[model samples]
Target: MSDSSTLPPARLRPEAELARDALSAPVLARAARLARWADAGTRVDAGGGLVEEQLPAAAEQLGLSGDDAAAHASEAWRIAVDTGLVEITDEETGTVAAGEDLALLTGGSPQDVLGVWLTALEAVLADASVPDLDDLVDAMAEGGEVDLSSLDWDPEAESDFLDGVLGNLYLLTVGEEGPGEAPVPLPALAASVIVPSDMGEPSNEVLEQVSDAMMRLDDQFRLLEPVGLVEYQPVDEALMADADEEPAAPVDEADVTRYGMVRLTPLGLYGLRARLLDAGFEAPAVGDLSDKGADALLDGTAPFPPAAAHAETELWLAGRSPLDAARELLAAARGTDPGAPLRRLRCQQALSLVGAEAEPALREVLDDAELGGLARVWLTEHGARDVPPPPQEMVFWLTIDTVAAQLAAEGNSEELRALVEGLARQHSGFFDTVWRVEHPATPEVLEAMGRLHPDKKVAKEARKAAFKARSQQGG
Candidate 1:
């Protein structure tokens, strides 16, 4: 994935809810239990791993059973150590004690608990990137020290690959056009990072690579599920064959689960967003602007998806009196900057959520040049009696402002094209009157209409009008 600064915002669950999830995740819960269970009597190896003799006892403590029970206990112990749930009191003596952070699980704020969980997640991610124990043992059997080349695992590359996969998963979960909470097919996800975006058809070699990535991800997600990062359906066991051979093509739709399917849990979204922010990514969440001023709310949510923006604005408005919020929003919306049109658009959307109590604030702005048209429209829509019609200049100015806002927000979208066509068709001479509007975005809006309007002659009229507006502005 590219630098995460460009990633879309993730709508995360509340911190308190996610903190509860972190505490209940199988891996984290076991790790916490083991942390509480450990005492001065507990012993660790030089590496701070639970001593070999204690593995069975630890598994029993976690009530874990099966062939993988001991391995699970060991993984939990490692997490306990890595996240400071258990401290290595004496490295030389391999003595262990409950760590300071162990107290945070019960006493700290939700953010503090989540911070510990993030640390544990990072440790798990590092462990997931490592080659299998069997592979490691085979490599070491030759001379005791493992040969990395023999294992064919580049630690950095493996780590980066997992990060890329997780990043792609994050995108799928949060992108406006993504699958949202629906489980992504494993084959599709593996291909996302393997197949070139510009490539029309994947080569045979590329397909093989994708297949290999799927198997690796199957293992990784299995490990990750215990940590509450993903809800995963593992690749079907029947599908596994010789590692060297490729399976047949065209997996049936019904058999998609045979390859695997995965979705990030809500907790996973919180965890990944935290990681992205730590890496200097500008990852925004819905309520991030709740405590901020109206100007921040309008400017900040300008780039958000409609639903996210509404959710954010709703939260921002929830704290203040509707009248106060309306006044603040109206004051912030009055600007001549390039971004001001979208700010006004956002303000209008936010005002729709305000009750009739904000009528006074709207009435106060009804005569202001920049705000009068929207105020009149809002008052009329709310059934305020005797709301006067906006003057022709105000109507045309608002039209230019609205079109400019749409262009900035949607970028010549299908809806905008339809809008441009409708505007030209509805008015006898739209371009002729629109060019004379005093709005700062008049020329730009006209130019966009010239490009978006499908009628050739109407499009020419819009371009001519835009040129006239530019010349008038220069004069």
Candidate 2:
């Protein structure tokens, strides 16, 4: 039979494509791990079906409880048996019958099982809507058994079959069982774009190739057209794919000597701006004139004239210049007067433009007593939403006051409610203090707090508070 077209498309990298096929590395890794674990001489005599005593031992070996192990093992056996990986003798026997071929064909170590699990994870990552690990765990805890027999698997396929199996498992685990909001799956196509190590200044060609690859993968996956390129360093180096051994020839400055300076394309600038936005950055202000102020600064080398500094600053903040020029302007503005409202604003704008390079300077200013408030606000706005606010006194007060004002000014109560709910869910520990002070204790507020609270006792406390507040208001 012809190769399955349903598998993800082949790699488009002209050079890399020839070096190796798009094998699921995670799957292979997981399977190999599991194989090693099973090889450690752990045997499950399913002749009398899966026994409770056998489960706890296996679970302990796997660093899990007996119930969890039994559940996972039973599910695995059921799936394997249905997929023809194992055989069953008696129809009445609920336990799996390990035929001679079972050990040789399917048996492996704990590491091997992990490899299998990861292989499945890789496949699930390809899809945008699959549930995450926590979701899967909860589903399993609810006694949901995965139906591996129903999945389409062909042993004869040329590509990695185990990878697909692991992918399905990963998907099943991450999927939501009830009609509730689920975790957003990071786009696979977006995930494929690799960032450089330095992240300072990649050659134009490298940037172009990455952008092109992103667009191509986006088309293949049918993902939403990204507003702009979002570049972030992997949290851990281990998360990154190993770089190719054969490196491309370094670009010489002499090669571009005849061309003078490289200018940023509008799209490139847009990508830069988007990247900043993704990092939680805001546009700097170049005075009152907006884009014009930025253009004037880009044209000349001198410090922005005081008369036009505000407009100029705003322009700088708006990210209107070539990347290098933008960087220079930002650095100069920061050096000139670090405390200038316009400077701070410009600094915020510049940090976003500079990407990770600005982290040190931003962090430094973030600790200054006078500058920290503005610096942190700007940083927090531009950085990851999950980043914790600075523990300083003024910053805390400013943030709380700002949030309160925002909640008060919100035009749509429904939207405000949702926003508040999300905030409370994410920072439930602060709910009693923040929510009560800023927002009136409505029935919706009580429900939202209760839903997001991890401890049942805390949720009960919140409900009681809401009830007391409501009763006092005679609602």
Among all candidates shown, the one with the greatest lDDT: 1
Where does the lowest 10-residue lDDT sum fall in candidate 2? 223-232
lDDT of 1 by residue, 1-475 (tens): 4454556668888889999999999888999999999988899999889999999999999999999999889989999999999999899999999999999999999999999999989988988999899989888845578889999999999998998899899989998899999999989999999999999988988988998898899899998998899999998777667666645334588888788899999999999988888878888987889999999999998888898898899999999999999999999999989999999999999999999999999999989999998999899889999898888899899889999999889898999999888888888977888898888898899999999888899999999999999988994
Q: Provide the global lDDT of candidate 2 against the true structure.
A: 0.37
Q: What is the TM-score of each candidate against the true structure?
A: 0.95, 0.20
True lDDT of residue 445, candidate 2 = 48
Give every collision pair in model 1.
none
Query: What's the TM for model 2?
Result: 0.20
Q: Distance from true position, residue 248, model 2, in Å?
A: 69
The positional error of residue 341 in candidate 1, measured at the CA in angstroms, is 0.7
Q: Which regions of candidate 1 fall more than 4 Å away from where they truly are?
A: 1-6, 141-145, 246-250
